[model samples]
Every structure is written in C-alpha cells, then in structure tokens.
Target: MKKQVLSYWLKDSQKKTYPRLEKNLNVDILIVGGGITGILCAYQLAKQNKYRIALVEKNRLYHSTTGFTTGKVTVQHDDIYHQLIKNKGETIARAYYQANSEAVQGLKKIVEEENIDCDWVDTKAILYAFSEEEAKRLQREQNAYDTLGIPYEWLDKETLPFQTLGGLAIPDQGVFHIVRFLDGILNNLNVDIYEKTKIIKTNPTEKGAVAETADHYKISAKHIVLATHYPIYKRFNFYFTKIKPTCSYVAIAHEFAIKPENAYINLIDPVLSIRFLDSADPKLMVAGFGHDVKNYYSYLDQIHKLKAMATERLGAKDFTEEWYNQDYESMDMVPLIGKITDAPLYLATGFRKWGITSAFVASLIIKDLIEGINNQYAYLYDPNRNKNTFKTVCYNFAMLSTVIKTKLLTVPKSIKINPGNGRIIQHKGSKIGLYIDQNGKTYSVKPICTHLGCTLRFNNVTKTYECPCHGSRFNYDGTSLDGPAVRNLTQL
Candidate 1:
C-alpha cells in the first residue's frame, strides 16, 4: 500500500515560506502556533491596528490538523446538543450552538468581503443513526433543538447510499477549503509570520512574557497565545491530564459511485463521516474510527479499516489520498479557551475534533479578552474552570494504567519483527525502538517519549513512534513530528 499524501485542499496550493527569527524581538502579542486559531486571532488583532503582532509556527502554516480535516464547517457535532443540554443546561447549550453558527456566518461574510475562492458551500449537515439506541439518542437531540428554538428536520430514511434507522438534518451549515480561507486571511493581514520556528519555552516577566525558540532567539510580548493544538506547558494547566488526544483516520477516493449532497456523520460508535469534494463530481471524503492514541497497537489497521469502509459501504474506488489527524478532546466536551489562570499566557485547545468553528470562536474570545472587551461566551470556555473534576479523575486513572502497563510490559524475545516495520524490544536492560526498511537497513532510537518520558509505541503505518502520555510523535530517525515535545528523541 502507498503511504499518505497531502490533502486535496493543499495539493494545488502554493507553499509560502517565511523567514526565521534571527534575533530577539519585542511585540505587543506573540502567537505560538500558525493554525486557524492563531491566524484568525492575528487577523482580528491586526484589523484593529492597535498592536504589533508576530506569529511563529513549528512547521508550515496549515500543514497540521487544520489542513488534514474533513473540511466540514457546521454546528451539528454528532448529536451534541442532547449531551450539552444534559450536562450544562439549555442556556449554555444554546450559547454553544449560537457560537458555532455565528462562526459559520462570520466565515461566510469574510469569504464574501475578501473575495476568496475556497469552494464555500452552504450545504446541510446530517447525523444518522445505525441502531435503535442511537436513533433514540438522536430523537433526544431533536428535542434539544426544540428547546433551543433551532430549526432541524428529523428523517426516518433518506437517499443515502447506506441504511440508517433515522437521521437529523440541520440547514445553513457549510464546508470550505480551510487552507484557502486561511491563506487569504494571512495574505490580507499585516502580521509578521515565521515558519519552522519551534518555541521551546515561555516564561512570564514582570511586565510581560518571553518566548524562547529552539535556536535561542527570544520574543518578548505583552501577551502570549498558545494556539498549538496541544499546549506545551503542562504544569500550569495540567492539560496533559485533562485533555485526551485521539488519533483519527481519513481517506479521499476518486471515481466514487455515490455523490453526497450534504456532510454526513453517524451517531454510533466508531463513527463514520462522509462528504463530497464537489456536488457535481464523484470525489468523496470519508473519515472517522477514532481511538485514544495510547490504545492503538497498529496504525495500519485503522487506515485499512477506513479504506475498507469507504469501498465496501460507500462504493468508493481508487483512493487518491489518505491521512491521519490527531485532536484533543476536552474532558467537559466544551473547548478550553481563555486566560491561563490570570497569567499573561493564553491558550486555545481541546476542541473535541471540532476545531474549525471552535477555532473561530476561540479567536473571538481571545481578542475580546486582550482588548478588555466583555464577551458573553467567555465563561463557557474558561480554561481554569473545574466543573468536571469527575471526568478529570477518571482520565487520570486511565492514563496511569496505560503508563504503568507500558513500563512493565514485556515482549517475547522469540517474536520476529517483519521487514519494513517497527517494534519495541528489550535490550541491555532498557527498551530500544527498532525499525527496518524494505531494503533491510536498520534504524534504531530510544523508545521513550521526549515530552513526559512516556513509553513510545511503534506506529507501522506512519513509521513513527507515538506517545501515549501526551501524543508527542517522533520519526524513525528520532526527529520530532508533533509536540508537547520540543526536543527529538535521543538516538540509541
């Protein structure tokens, strides 16, 4: 099987590189991530013309989760209304819907005003159920819509290529080429951007905060925003424990048999999402089958399952591209966006696999907070709020079990690892990560994660070592792929 390639949105886009920071610089605001959250935040702040802004990215902009997404921009997040209303209240649930809906509308206005061609489509979003239990849950979600006065349609069956017990359809929801939209905003904004500039540390001074890059260049800013998908600092927020990172798979197929009119996701376990790249063509995108990163024994199995589902269930043929996305799910189900406990540092993360709309919403809240303007949705997404301690406790327990299991487990010495594959083996009283390419060349590295020292697992599909503790990933050659880990693994 062929390895994953770039997403359809990024295939034809021109790559724009920015200079790295050569010396220490001072700015009004310094953003540490170049994803949608950081880009939008910089745009909103730059439009006001009040502060000097600088944004830094570890890699190229939009090459992370923002570009790897399924490109669905909607408020219908898999029968979420029912759960929100039950957990928080009708008032907060309505606010959550309003926040995301307004984000969609805001994006539409931006695309129109800026004259961007990101294939923006005002399509419907549908959530289907495969079993009676899921159908009942969807019915409760419909009731939530009623409570919130939101318009929706309940369907027993539709024109979908697959069978479903029932479904929920919400109109005026949409999808767009997120990379194009972000690129347009970046082009129009006057913010200083630096790519391939990884930040290693950020500490608060008396007046502000200082961010130090891996190259030892410093950026002093009055305010700092950690828009990195996973916050680098774990001590202040304990985000490593509270936020659960999951690995999800996606595949794009050409010559698909059925064209979907709207974005579709199911309400059952191992959720499957479907949508078309173009309403006029047979190009289709299917994504889902998420699991906690630590629980995955073989990444290839997940990719194979997604491809099988696309071909067998959705009649997809000749997959053109496939990729994986990692996202952190907040314990409370609401995104954490706001000040990090009265410090100058701010954060936007834990979007629960719904970062597109949440990123926009976070930008708005962060902008308002920095400008001393009151936002109505601020309290709902407060990072310091500990209303869901039960979930946090349960998550900590589960994490401890995984950590202990990784430290104590042993692999049989007789088991032979295959060529072009990786395995963790006990060697000389320590665990060693070993990978052999198809040509029979050996590549070895220390298997421990550089982030929090969690044991790393071998991902056969990506040919990388993944951390179960905090989702840090490393290449076979010990180079860092994702973080929470600023340093690469130590070569054995």
Candidate 2:
C-alpha cells in the first residue's frame, strides 16, 4: 500500500545505493540499520575522525519507520512525565525529560550547523484530553509538569481552536523532514555505506566480530551496533522477550483545509497525533497513530474511524495516501541503548513508538561508547539492565498469552477461499499460508516466520499472517510482510 507520505519526499530525498559486502574487510565499527539512529551515529562517529564505520541496511535507507514518522521532534509525549513520576520516580522522570529535551536541541543544532533545508520549524505541541476521566489525568500531568519545572501552557475549550475540554501545550517544539536531515548527514561522509547487504549470520570470535552475508563475504569490525530496529542478534540481549513489536498507521491528506498551527496528540484511549507539512504544490496534514499490529483485528475498526475523524476534523477533501509502520515497544517504556555484552557489541531498540528523539539519543550514546567516554544516561537504556518489576512481568505475561491464543486459535486446516480471500492452511506438519484469486487459482507460500522460524497465523480482519514468536508479518499471498524478517515468504 503506497501511503501519501512518499510523495512528500520522493523528489528531495537522495537516491544513493551502497554496494553489499562481498569480501572480507575491516573497519573500526559496523553499524547495522540505516535508519535515523545508525545514520546519525555514523555521521557523529565520522566527525571524530577516529573510527572507520560501515553502515548496512537490509533495504533502502529512510524507507523504514524513520521515513514514515509524524516528524514531531519534541520532548512533549502524551502525558509521559506524570506516568513516569508515578511508576519510576521524580529523579528518573526528570532525567527522561532532560534526555529528550537535549535530544530535541541536538537535532535542531545539527540541522542548522549542516545547513539542511528540511523545512524545520519551531511550534508548540498540544496534548488534548477527550474525556472527563482523561481531563482529570491531565490535571495530574499538569502537577507533574509543575514539579519538574517544565514550561507549558494549560488551556480550556474556550482558549483553543479545537473542542477538547482541556489540554496541555508545550512551546518551542519542532518538526522536520527526517530524510532530509539524514541526507544532510550523509552528503559527503567518508563512511563505507552498503545496501542490499543482508547480514545472514554473526559469529563472535575471541578477538572481535565477523558478519557473514549470503554473498560470501566476511566483514570484520572491532565493534558492532545492532540498530536493525529489533536487533538481529537475539542471543545476546533476549530482545524478543524484553521488547515486543507493534505497528501504527499514518495518512497524509493534501486537500485538507484549516490546518492547526502546531503538532497535536490526544490523551484519550484511541489516540490521534497530528503534524503539518509544507510540500511543493499543496500543504499536507499528516494524522495517524492507530492499529497496534500485534492486535491488528482489535483496532481494525479504529483505523477506519480515525480516517473518518481526520477527514472531518481537518476538513480533508480527499485522502491521498495511507501507510503503516511497525515499531518495537520496550517493557519499561524507554529505549534500549548500550552494549548488549562484554564483546564490543551494542544495540538501540524499543523507542516505544517515539523514534525521532530516541534515535537522537542513541546516536549520542553510540558515539560515547566508541570514544570510550562515560555517558551518564547509559544505565537508563542498558540492554542487560533487566529490573523486571511486577508491571513488566504482567505486561509480558499478557503478551505471551495473547500470542499463544493467536497461534493456537482454531483456524481451519484448509479452507476453500475465494479469489479475493485468504486461508490458513496446515501443511508440511506446519502451518502454511494460501491466497486465491477471483479465478479460484491458489498461491501457496511458507507461513513460517523469517525470525525464529515460528509458524504464523492468519489475521481475518486485516488479511495478514503474523508471527507469534517475534511479531513478523506476511501478506496473504505468502509475501514477507515486516522485519527482522528480511525476505518475502518463499512460494511452495
């Protein structure tokens, strides 16, 4: 599904392809994944004039979740400070706020210093309360803000343009084209860039690390950064258990009128986040944040309802494009950054649906690790720092039960599907997926996931097969849907 987002950047984005690793090579660092984090880390590391870095992305750069972000680079998330204070503490909550605030400042500084024309703009971020219960929650959030001494404006219905009864607005927040910022960093860097290079295996030796690609090459690096969304090397950190994956939808409407001046998000159950963009011909309002891919059918109805709400709220005359992006959510609600083990391996994942600021912080942490400097915020994102509290245990337990139920649910062994319908088929002592066309011709493909080899289940509402083990996804005709799985499902 081509979302309306690509049109916003297809013309301005750099189209450069890096060759895959085909032979043994050595570098100071090997950064996996070319999204914002890896790219920014490479740029920062290169600035030090010390480490020779090689960044590898399984596919094209910026086409991942980074490209699909709502692009609001702000520290103001949906009432996070209040929740953090209640769950963690005031000190850690303040640390969280400072870390993100510094990140936002770092981003603006980088864009300005690099002279990147990414349509950067300073604006306020609004968090609206949809119900009275939510409004009371907002009052508590306001208290947290006061305790933290953060600058914000609390408003009622009569003060704002929207109908929300109460809301919180934080000033001096910003948004920009993430791809343009990435391109600004990549313009003339000396780093070795590789695309179409899939890391099939990673073998750790007594000395360092060697990544083996299917193309018969062994690339060696003194240190490794597994920024591949969900780290490909699961053995070191037990990432699959620590952080589960989810997907969200985004829509960019060109014909929308009466756009709001600032980026906006709601405090209610089914949240709606809004951001504005100025394109060449027509300005666009990007609104989304729906459908947790893990529970695709659960929010299938909400996706449509959000679309209608967006159309009605912003006066969107026409819906140009909509696309979905998946993210890994950590149990602690903070991103995982830092070394996974003692052998010079590092990772950054589980941004908890906030990639922009998390990526910025990850880049800083990676640079500090490479330069052998002590980063004060290292413990907050330590991959091995598992303080599994009661809430974390309960959340993972529920997640496991959900996955088990989804997998063991009574699905037809093999059903006769229509041309436009798909079916869950059990074959080869395992579950395989099948899709039929209008002519009743069938296409068979492996329903096993690319990650951990778990058989997938068919999601009737969205018509996609999802992996129970690592949350990988597949389209109806057995096409590989999402990552940690690099390739499409093989046709049988």
Candidate 3:
C-alpha cells in the first residue's frame, strides 16, 4: 500500500533537520502551527521590529498545508461571492474581496521585495459553471464582484478551450512556488522557530500563557496564535463545533501537460480543482473527491475514481503523487480570525479550502490584534461571533452528536469474532466493524477512533469503517484513512 501521497518536491531534494526546544524561554509573542498561517504570523510580527516572536511547529516547517497546497495563491474561490452577497450583502462580499485582494498584493510585494524566485506568476483565475443554475450563480457572483469594485471579465461558451457554459475570469490572479515563498520569509526572521515539537498541554498564567511541549519545556508568551491546522487546545473555543472538515484527494500526473495560463475549479458539487505545476515536464494537479475524513474508504475510493477520471478524461498517462489533505469549512462561509475570548488567546481557522488567501488576511488581522492596531475586518471574523442561523445550529449539533456518540458507544462481539467484509455486527450491546480480507483472513480491532476515541461505524457505500468523532476513519485491514487521528486502528 502507498504510505504517503507522492509529492513532487520530495524528489531530488536534500533532507534538512531542524532543532527542538530544550529550554524554558519567554517571548513577547508566540505563534503555533508552522504552516502558511503560523509562518505568515511570524513574518508580519517580525516586520514591526517591536516584539520578540517565537514560532513552534510540531513537524517540519512549511511541510504541512503550505507545502501540500495546489499553490494557486489566487483570490477567486468556488463561486463563494454569491453566497456572501446573498447572506450578508454586497458590503461583506466586498470586504472578502478587499481582504483577499490585499493578500494577493501582499504576496506580490513579498516576491518583488525579497527577490525570491519561487516561479511566481501573474495569471487569470477562472471559475467554470457547468449547469445553467450554476451559471446564474456565476452571474450573481460577477455582480457581487462588480459591486465590490473587483476587476473581472465574463467569458461565454466558445470563448475558452474547454467545454463549459461560461466562466468568470479574475485578472491578475496568480500561482507560485509555496516552498520558496516560505523559505524566503523564514530565512530572514529573527524569530525563534522550533520543529519536531508537539505541544501536549497549554494553560493561561497570571501574566501571559504557558505552552508545555512534549520535550518538557514551558514556553510563555503574552499572546498565542493556534495555527495548527487543527488547534491542539480543546476546551474553550469549541472549534470542533463551528467547523466541519473534509479530506480531499490529489494527484499529480505527467500526461496532458499544459500549465494553463490560470487555474480552475468547478462551481458545483463534487468540486474539481485543476492547476499546473511549473517544471521541466509541467505536471498537472487534479484534485477532487472531498468528503469527511471519517469516511476513509469513501475518500480513498473517490481518489481512485479521480485517478481513473484523469486517465480517461484528462489523459493522465502516469501519476507521480497521490495524497490526501484536510480543510475546515466554516459555518459562516468566512474565516474565523480574532480572539477566542476576551483573553489573549487568538485563533485563525475555518478557511474553507481557501487558506492560502485567507491565511494572508489572517496574518494581517492577527498582527494588528497583537500590535493593538484596530483592524476593520477583525469584528467580521471574530471567533466568538455567535450567530444562531438554522444552518449553523444544525452543523454544530451534528458535530456534538458525533462527538458524544463516538465516546460513549461500544463495538459488538459479532464484529469482534469475525470482522467480516467491512460490515458492522452486534457484539454484547455494541455495534462493531468486522472485516474479512481477500485472503480469507479475519481480524478484529477496537472499532473506535484513535483521535478522540470515538466508536467506529461501517460505511457500506465507502467500504470503510468511519469514526463519527472528529472524523478519523480506517480501511478493512485496520489501516488509517485520515486524521485528526494520526495512527491506524489497533488489531485484536
């Protein structure tokens, strides 16, 4: 079985090691999560030359979402302006445009200012609508964009090479090398960065806060930024409630190599996003099959289907990489960036698959909050904003129900004995998943998620065992499907 999704960057690259935190240290500010959000936080704060910032990453810096991104670096997401305009009005939609536009400009400024050659390019980003209803939505989005003073053009059918009804093209959009962008920022920072460091526990102190790492170091700071794609601290913010994450499958292939002048994503269900890698061969990154991480085989099977689609539709001769990624879709269709409470605890999450653009805005908002400079967009994205719309309430309740059930349930004995064919069987007042493999072998595991320890449910449609808790899942053979849970199931 394939262990890791093949990443093109991992090839022909020298391995580099980073240091771990070994001493108790105090800093003016502390940033957690070394992905795009954390690194950008450090970059913004360091620019001020005021506070002493310390950034910590549990794993390799930039190897998280930032490294794994399709790397569009554009402002156009899947027809989102329509919903933003419908719910909050054009003003908020414009605010979204303003924030993302500023982020795009910020990236451009960094590329020019730092003289970093990360294959950064100025391109047009297009969102194609496959159906008439979606096309109407696209028009509404165009209107919203116009109302927001965003520069864009509409292309009808026969205007593009691909077969589609119409598309909305945002000019001066972009694609770039994420690694180079991160490396440039990290290379010049005076901030203290720790890699291979996992923060096991965190608590607030009389003055600031203390982050206790696995290595036994208590690092304190006046403020904290939970940049970990999923925040480690669990009690207060109720992050698991406000957001539902989906795991997406991605593939990089060599055939049909045309790095489009832009990037594209279908504005309908079963979202398919396509972008090109700039290299000698110029491979294509085709991403689709987004489902909750708890539906392991569902996503994996969907990935397999996507690979087949690439071969059949897009003419992908061979694939170099196949990996899975997680994105937290927000309840309000916008990012959550601001103080979690009245305290110095700050959060940046719920980017809804638009972390690259949103993370830049988050860095701006977070730096301003830390510097005491009042930012206008801060209130819009406040982590504590409590709107009880039916949709938001339902989403939260679903997550709560999943968490409770995951913790309280037990697997059945039928599943324990046979474990046949990825099906659920009753065992002593519990429902357990049973799997019998192709070799006529039977195995039993605690049919519970390792992440939050949720009981597992068999998904017949996806042919995998799912955890309703925090969305970790497994295959029939007791292998891990996705995270919040980093480990696979335990065999009995």
Each model's number of backbone clashes?
0, 5, 9
Instruction: Report lDDT (Cα) of residue 86, candidate 1.
Output: 93
Tell me the tens digit of each residue's lDDT in model 2 across 331-425: 77888898867667778988877888988899888789877899877877887776676766876677666666655755567666767667677
Which runs in model 2 stand beyond 4 Å of their true positions?
1-12, 279-286, 289-291, 298-300, 409-423, 426-430, 435-443, 452-454, 457-465, 474-491
Q: Candidates sorted by lDDT, descending order?
A: 1, 2, 3
What TM-score, to 2 decimals, does candidate 1 have?
A: 0.94
lDDT of 2 at 247: 68
Per lDDT, the best of the predicted structures is: 1
TM-score of each: 0.94, 0.89, 0.84
| Arranged by TM-score, best first | 1, 2, 3
lDDT of each: 0.84, 0.75, 0.75
Which residues of candidate 1, in runs, are more than 4 Å off? 1-5, 158-161, 411-421, 435-443
In model 2, the clashing pairs are 4-321, 247-293, 419-437, 419-438, 480-489
